[model samples]
Target chain A: MKTLSLRNLQKTYFDPYAGSQVTAVHDVSLDVEQGEFVSVVGPSGCGKTTILNMVAGFIPYSGGEILLDGAAVKGPGPDRGVVFQSFALFPWKTVLENVGFGPKMRGVPKADRDRIAREYLELAGLSHAADRYPNELSGGMQQRVGVVRALANNPAVLLMDEPFASVDAQTRMTLQEELTRIWQERKPTVIFITHDVAEAVFLANRVVVLSKGRVLDQIKVDLPRPRVWDHLMQDETFKRLSAQVLQMVRSA
Target chain B: MIASGQRTGSKTPGSGWVWRTMNSLAGAAVFVAPLLALVAIWAIVVPLFEVNPRIFPSVASVADAAADSIRDGSLIRHIGASLLRVGLGTLIGVVTAVPLGIAMGVSPAVSSFLTPLFRFFSVLAGIAWIPIATLWFGYGFGAIVFVIFNAVFFVVAYNTLLGVSTIPMTIRNAAASLGARRWALLTEVLLPGALPNIVTGVRTGLGFAWRGLIAAEMIATNVGLGYMLFVARDFYRTEVIVLGMIVIGLLWLLIDRLLLVPLERATIERWGLVRRT
Candidate 1:
């Protein structure tokens, strides 16, 4: 069953001074099945973020609709957790507090919320830094906190917007592995957006390439689990898949 | 390597104690330099001109007046009176201003319409309020404190509104997506995000209030630093007037440096989101 669906989503911004209108996203439609890890790759300003924002209910669409689990997305809710590109962790909050934020908002018991937040922190491999402020942590560690914060609520779908784009190369590789492990364990439908082709290929079960606010192609990655970066990069099949994604992103 | 050495030095046992002692001395020297220079200039110029002791006194004479006031305990009474008024006024202003500002700033349309109103009122807060405050409260501590309260309130409210409005939409959206309710969003995201600006506003407002307090005291009050200066002016006691001026300057410097600067630094250190170069 499809966990999420977008039907002919359209977005336009009016320029009063210019006496004209600009179409940001035009007639875009896509669907994601249950437990699917889908990556959306596109060029800059191609409305990839707009699509994600619409699904997250951050902005209203001019036309069409977004349905999550057979219901229209009215506004931002706990059922769809979003991890932003900038790792927007509250500066005043420690790692544990940030992670527990969702549960606390839901009026969960203090002990239960703390326990769940601790588990998510450990899952993100940030147990040692749970008491530290976001500024005290590295960029990768901050992103980990963002992810844990989102996941603490046990959302039905996890939305990631270039989650690893700001991290160092080595940290990015490690995070990808950790993400894949967490995805397998939790089994939430994931929609990851990135400009990096290799990232799309490595972590996604299926890759959806978008261009000019339209879905260009959807390819299934039938590879095995527990993927290792070093060995996988050497494989001819991995290279071929990366080349295809690269071609789509470049042309877009 | 230098960075490592600095880090190690910062962390070494007993180093913090030594560093804090040195830091305080450095801070005090920075504060005291200008006052010392001003005093030296006064000493040189007064003697050079052989100025009338009625209009302006010699540095030695001003020092003697200061000692006399201190010994008589009038200096303590004046200082205490002024401090009490300022404390009460600031407390009332801050408690009122912060909430009103946040309420106004929460909505875009409301905030835009009200911003100009706040700007106009803030401009008229301090010195302009003196005549009306004196009319309403009559000549005494009440009138003087009213002026100080008016000075702090509008400025703090204006700055708090700006602070709340300037928070990035992305941060708010991020918090919302992470399941923050209205109350949670306000407390966690809005308040901390606006803290640096609020602290800055408080500092600026207090500066205006301090000045307004002096001006009000001169006009309305029977006892205070400004009253002391005014009384000295009437009696042609130039030495006493000079002493009062020095005391005012020193007191303000102490409040700004010792109290406000550290408070601002601690807040920014704790809740500031932006990285400093």
Candidate 2:
């Protein structure tokens, strides 16, 4: 089943400085299946983030339609949870409260929401940090909270926009591995937008390469599941797929 | 594993509250040392210079004046009146300004219309209000409170507006995506997000209000510390004037250190991310 469908999606904005209209995303169409993990990969200015933002209902699409479970997305809603690159955890809230925010918003009782939060926090290996604030955590840990906070909402689809781009290289690998592990267990449909070719290949079932705001190609990852850096780093298929995506991205 | 409540911003995380409190007391003593040194200078200079009694009262004479005021209970009344005025005015100012500031924050049109007015008034907020306040309310409590209100209202409103607007777009988006309704966004996100700045505004505004309160009280009221100072001047009671001045300074210090600083430290500094950083 198509959980998220974008039909001829387009975004055009007036450039005040340039005194003309600029098309950021031009005539793009895609479908993400239920329980599918799709990574949208592109070079800078390819409008990959813009596409994710549109799907997340963060920004209005100037043209075409984005349907989630055959329903049009109007504005940001709990149905489409987003994980931001900045690790936008509520600094004022403890990690548990941050995770519980969604359920709380849904009018879940405090005890039940906290239980849900604790469950997600444990899933992220962050059970110990539940009482800590976002600013108190390292970048990697904060992003872990970011991931679960979205998941705890039980959204129809998760939108991640370069969520690990800001973290250190070592932490990024760990986060990517953790994300795949969580994805395998939960099977939450996700649209992961990234500029990183290897990351896109590592995380998604299918990698959609975007060029100049359009889908250039979609690469299916036939790599086996339970993806881990320890094995995947040395796997021949992983290297080949990554190289292909990297070449496309660098050229595009 | 750090205890959430015990996490003092920039302190060794999970430090015991008792330990922190004792250490803060030591820190306060360090802070007060310079003021004590200034008083020592005052003590020595007055006697050494052979200063006239009418010029600057000696420290000992100021102490005697303090004793006399304490005995008569006049000082307590004055202080109580001044405290009540400042407290009521600030309460009113904060209550009214916060919602308006939130309105300004959430809507661009409201902000555009109000921003210039707030900015303009904040600069001219304190003593400038005193003249008009007295004319509006007549010479007494109402006038002085009005002056204090004017001093706090604009600055806090402007700061709150700034605080809300400056919150990153991502955070707001995240909150919305988490199903935060408009009211929830205001209460949970915007209010807490803006608290550090709001507290800062209160701290700054109170400084202005304190000055304005004193000026207004001197001009318009027969009681309070400012009135006490103004009346003492007529009798050439330099000791009484000096005592009132010292009390004014100490009261402001106490308010800032005990009330405002701790407030900022507990909520915003440790929990809510401060607006600037």
Candidate 3:
């Protein structure tokens, strides 16, 4: 059964100063099943992030509906956790505090929240840096904290917008691996957005190609799980899937 | 794994609060040393020039006057009066202005409508209020405090409004997504995010208020630092005047360095886009 569904989703922004109405996300439809990892890949200005934002309920959709387990989303809530591209961990909060903020907001006791945050931080291999502020961490570590912050709530769906796009290639690969490991362990339905086709193929159960505000195609990755990074580039199936998605993206 | 290992792992340097504070104080002393040297030069230069006592008192004579005031308890009374007026006026101004600013700033239309109004008042803050204030309150503590209040109010309000509005929308959105209700959003996100600006506003507002307080005391009040200095001028008591001036300068420096600067630094370091110096 689909855990999250987007039906003919559309987003239109009217720029008053420019006096023009531009549609950011034109009619796009997709379904994400429970425990499934879906990556939305698109060119610049294609509005893949807009779709993710809609799922996260950060903005109102001009047309169509977003449903979680057949219930329409009203606005942003703890049920759907979003990880932004800029690693929007509250700078004022310590790593543990940032991770535990969702639970604290839900009236979770301080001790319990700390334990949960620490557990997630350990999973992200950031247990030692729990008390440190966001500014003290590197870009990669900060993003790790961002991911755990969203996951600490045990949300039904995880919405990520180019989570690793800002990091260096080496750090990106490491973060991608860490993310996959956490997702496997936690089993939250995730909708990841990225412009990198290779990253989309590497981390997704299914890669949805988007172009000019529409989904061009949804390509399923039948590659084996516990996908190792060192061997991924060598695998015939991984290479084929990546090449297909890359071709679709380029053609668009 | 390599990246994680490279992340300044485990042994976080400068971890303890006491050590960090000591480090900062040492840094502050470096900045303060130059001012101390200027005082030393003043002590030497005035005596060497053999300047007239009525024109500019020597450091020794100023010290003697300060000692005399301390013995008589008038110096304490004047300082206490000035501090009380500034403290009360600033407290009232901050309390009222912050909420009003936030209310106006929350809406684009309201903020734009009120921007010019606040700008006009902030420009006319401090000394500009003295004439009307004295006329209304009749040359006493009330008039002096009113001047200080008027000095701080508009500037703090304007800054608080700017602070609240300048917060990035993404941070607010992120907070909302994380299950923050209205009150939580304001206290947790909005307040903390705007803290740096609010602190800056207070600092600037207090500066204007301090000057206004002194000016108002000189013109209208009978028991404050400014009044003491003004009264000393009638007797050609340059020593007393110099003593009063030194006290004012030292007090301002102490407040700015020990209190305001540290507050600004901590807030900006914690939540602002600007990094620590």
Candidate 4:
């Protein structure tokens, strides 16, 4: 079943001062099946984030519809969770509070929400820092809190916008591995947006390449898991796929 | 790279209490030095010039007057009266202005239209309101409190509006996407994001209020620091006038350094999510 579908999505931002409309996303359409790990890759300002924003109902699209579980997305809801690039954890909130926010918003019992948040925090290897505020944590640790916050509510679909972009290279690799493990265990339909082709190829079951606010191609990653970082680099199949994706990205 | 386990965290070689006490003492010294210097200059210059003791008192005479006022308890009464007015006016202004500002700021069009109105009023807050406030509220406590209220209100409202409007759209969107409801977004995201600005506004507003308080007291009130200074001028009691001036400066310095600065620091340190340059 198609868990989520974007049909000819178009977005136009109006410049009130200039008296002109700028087309940010144009005629982009895609679908994600249940339990699919789909990654969207594009150059900077290619409107990939715009598509995610549309699906998350953060902005109004000029045209087309975003259907989640066969219903139109009207506005932001608890059914979908989004992880932002900047790790927008509430600074006033501790790790545990930030993670528990979604469930608390849904009016879940405090004990249950705390339990769920604890599970996700442990999954993200941030249980030890649960009581600490976001500012006290490192970039990687903060991103872990972001991930845990998104996953705590057990939403049907997860939308991530360059979730690991701010962290260091070492932390990024570790987080990628941890994310893969979590996805395999939880199996929520995910639509991940990133500029990095290697990151997309490593985590995604299907990779959609976007350029100039339109879909260029969608490639399938047929590799088996648990996929090790070192093994992925050494594998000839991985190399070939990476080269192909890199070529497309460069051309775009 | 050092192994995590092998890395030893550097210690500052002092207990938290010791460090805090030292910091406070240093801060106090830094604050007091200038005032002490000014006093020393005044003491020396006044005697050297042999200026009329009526116009400017010697240090010894001013010290004697200060002691007399303290002994009689009139100094405490005047200080208490000024503080009460400022305290009451500030409380009322903050309670009223914050919600109104947030409501107006939530809508961009309304906020933009009303911004000019706030700016105009904020400019006219302190000394300018004195003549009218005295006319409407009569002399003494009412007039002084009205002046202080006007001084704090408009500036706080303007700052609150700016604070809410300055929140990045990205942060709001991220919160919305993460399942924050309207109330949650307001309390968790909007409030904290605007806190630093609000604190800054309060500091600025209080500064204006303090000045306005003194000026209004001088013109329209019977019992306060400004009144004390004015009465001393009439009686040619330069010693009392000098003491009053010193007291005013010290009071303001204490309010700003002890109360306002720490409050601002805590807000920026805790809720200011963005890194400083």
Clashing pairs in 3: none
Question: CAPRI band of model 4?
Answer: acceptable
Model 1, residue A80: distance off in Å is 1.6
Model 2 segments more than 4 A misplaced: B1-18, B275-277
Instruction: Flag regions of model 3 displaced more than 4 Å.
Output: A16-18, B1-32, B270-277
lDDT string for model 3 (A112-185, tens) is 99999999999999998887779888999999999999999989999999989899999999999888888888
Model 4 lDDT at residue A133: 71
Per-residue lDDT of model 4, residues A104-156, tens digit only: 88788989988888988998888787777788788999988888788887777
Best by lDDT: 2
- Rank candidates by TM-score, best first: 2, 3, 4, 1
For residues A23-42, could you state the per-residue lDDT of candidate 2 as single tens digits?
Answer: 99999999999999999999
Model 3's DockQ? Answer: 0.47
The TM-score of chain B in candidate 4 is 0.91
Q: Can you list the residue pairs that collide in candidate 2?
A: none
Cα lDDT tens digits, model 2, B143-182, are: 9998898899999999999888887889999999999989
By the lDDT metric, which is better: model 2 or model 3? 2
Ranking by lDDT: 2, 3, 1, 4
- How many times do residue backbones clash in model 4? 0
